[model samples]
Target: MNPKVTDYISSNIKWQKELEIIRNVLLELPLEEDIKWGIPAYIYKKKNIMGLSAFKNYCGLWFHHGCFLKDEINILINAQKDKTKGMRQMRFISVDEIDTDIVKQYVLEAMANSEAGLEVKPKKNTNPVVIPEELNIQFSKNEKLKYKFNEFTLSKQREFCEYILSAKREATKQSRIEKIIPMILNKIGLNDKYRNC
Candidate 1:
């Protein structure tokens, strides 16, 4: 067991028992502890294998390969609605809610999946709008904004541009552009400011 992670989890009584149970189960596996998304994440090799966290009403045992796992326990929850094929979550309302046998099976399967090299299907691109001429004009006018936008990686630029052009109405598109211009100028990528670094 990792002393740092155990110490962190020990502070929360409700989560302590749950973490202890999970830690005991995964004892034989090669594991490391790190903080990810502000939660305690467990890694196998270099891949994120699982995470333990508490929510408002439940504690979560998240599987990084959950979307691919055959959930015999039927306790897994699809946490992300926008993405169809990545990282499923298993929520436990209480320590009693966990099925230790099933969780161990899942951990073993996840390790095997990692060894076999499986990846989630990438999300499809749904937006089809081209960049507006007016937006291009605005970008051209602000040299700093243009430079900042250029400094962003292709994927990051695509995210901001897609967000602006994806709106159904011209008014909404303009509104989004207005809201995002300062973010672009500040060299912050979409979702970067909100995500815990």
Candidate 2:
């Protein structure tokens, strides 16, 4: 059990009771509980099986590989439509909506699927990394940074490239480039901080 998850559930004034009701069912599963993405997540074999979260309007469960579930109850919905590939959400508005027995059944099935090596592997990002003009200008100024950047895996290089391009204004792009120079030189990936959790 992670102390952070206690703070998470306790902090949600709107859905604390409802979340706790569902959490009781999740607790019965043979999974390790910890916090990931700053939310309560249950792990099986080091893979995230599900997570608990709260919003202003609702509290919900996030199934990490929910696409594989039979979902005969029709409770699962893709939270992000086309943008989200495999994750599905089962949202609840109140304590009355929870059915612990069904929840347990779903979790047991998900665990079985996970143990069977079922997964929705994301398509490979084959598109070439596009270096923004601002980044190119910076690279021209600091040749060593450019040299070091190429040493990284394509995914890492693309992360840095997109980081600069994602900023709307020129100043923001320049600042983002400046911010990442040290990281690039040190061979650090941009999202490294969140990756472990």
Candidate 3:
């Protein structure tokens, strides 16, 4: 067991036993175990295969390429139906909720899929990204900002645009623009803090 993952699972005061059972089951597989996003993640050839996470209500397994799994028993769930594409989660409310045999089958399938080089293709961004007027003006005024904004990936650009547009008032929009200008200049994504973790 990875010391970091052991510490993380042991620290789950609310679901220690549940987390430990999940951890032990995963350990029986061939994947390498490590800590990621403060959770126990199983990796195959440096690619994330599955991860264990504890939430307020449950501890769950996050299957990285779950979109590709056959899921013959129909247990895999799309945690975020619309936003999540490749990942799926199998949630457990308690240690008793875990069916070790079923879980093992799923893990083995996932490991096999990884070994077979199966993957879920990223969804293509088809719609044109919406750029708010506040950002448009900023881009027009500063060549560097314009260049930097253009340099961002389509998703990053969309995040910034959505953030600015979500503000209800002009002042709020302007405030958001001001706050994000440095981040744009630095080429950082709007949700980098959350995503990086």
Candidate 4:
């Protein structure tokens, strides 16, 4: 275990024993420790394998490719109802909620799947728009907007694009574009604009 991660684990005692057990299972796998999404993440060859996190009422062991695994142990939970596939979470309400052996087997299987390059096929895009022509045109015409949009993080850009293109009607798309233009021109991300308000 990485010393930093060990220290992180040691700092929290609410579910110390349970966390320890889960840690042992994860450490046994050939994985590397890194910080991702502001939390301790385990990766195999650059692909995320799993992550450890704590919540107000529960702690979770997240398998990045959990949706791809044939979960006979029935350990997976659908955290989001709208998401059809790609990620799943196993939440533990308390120390006693953990099943060490079963969790270990799941961890092992997750690692094996990672090593084998297994992946859940991404959901196909169902939106009607074939990329926004306005986005390209607006971006090309405005150097400041282009710079700001480029400066925004990948997730932020994705959010903006998804929000704009998510509209089913042309009027809604135009309205979204109108709302987003100033935010982009000002070098502010979609969430940042809302957050500051």
lDDT (C-alpha, whole model) for all candidates = 0.76, 0.87, 0.88, 0.77
* Higher-ranked by lDDT: 1 or 3: 3
Residues 17-64 of candidate 2: C-alpha lDDT, one tens digit per residue: 987888777877788888877789999988889999999888898998
Question: Against the true structure, whose TM-score is highest?
Answer: 2
Task: Tell me the tens digit of each residue's lDDT in model 4 across 1-197.
Answer: 67767766777778667677788777777779865665568888788888888776878788888877789878798787587466788889877788878887787788788788788767555554343776777778887777887777666777788887788998998899889988877877787734442
- What is the alpha-carbon lDDT of model 4 when measured against the actual structure? 0.77
The segments of candidate 2 whose C-alpha lies over 4 angstroms from its true place after superposition are: 186-188
lDDT by residue for model 3 over 80-161, one digit each (tens)? 8888888999999987889988888888888889889998878678789999988999988999998999999998899999
Off by over 4 Å in 4: 121-143, 150-158, 161-197
For each candidate in turn, give its C-alpha RMSD to the true structure in angstroms: 3.9, 2.0, 2.5, 6.2
Best first by TM-score, ranked: 2, 3, 1, 4
Error of 2 at 175 (Å): 3.3
Ranking of all candidate structures by their lDDT, best first: 3, 2, 4, 1
TM-score of 4: 0.65
RMSD in angstroms between candidate 3 and the native structure over all alpha carbons: 2.5
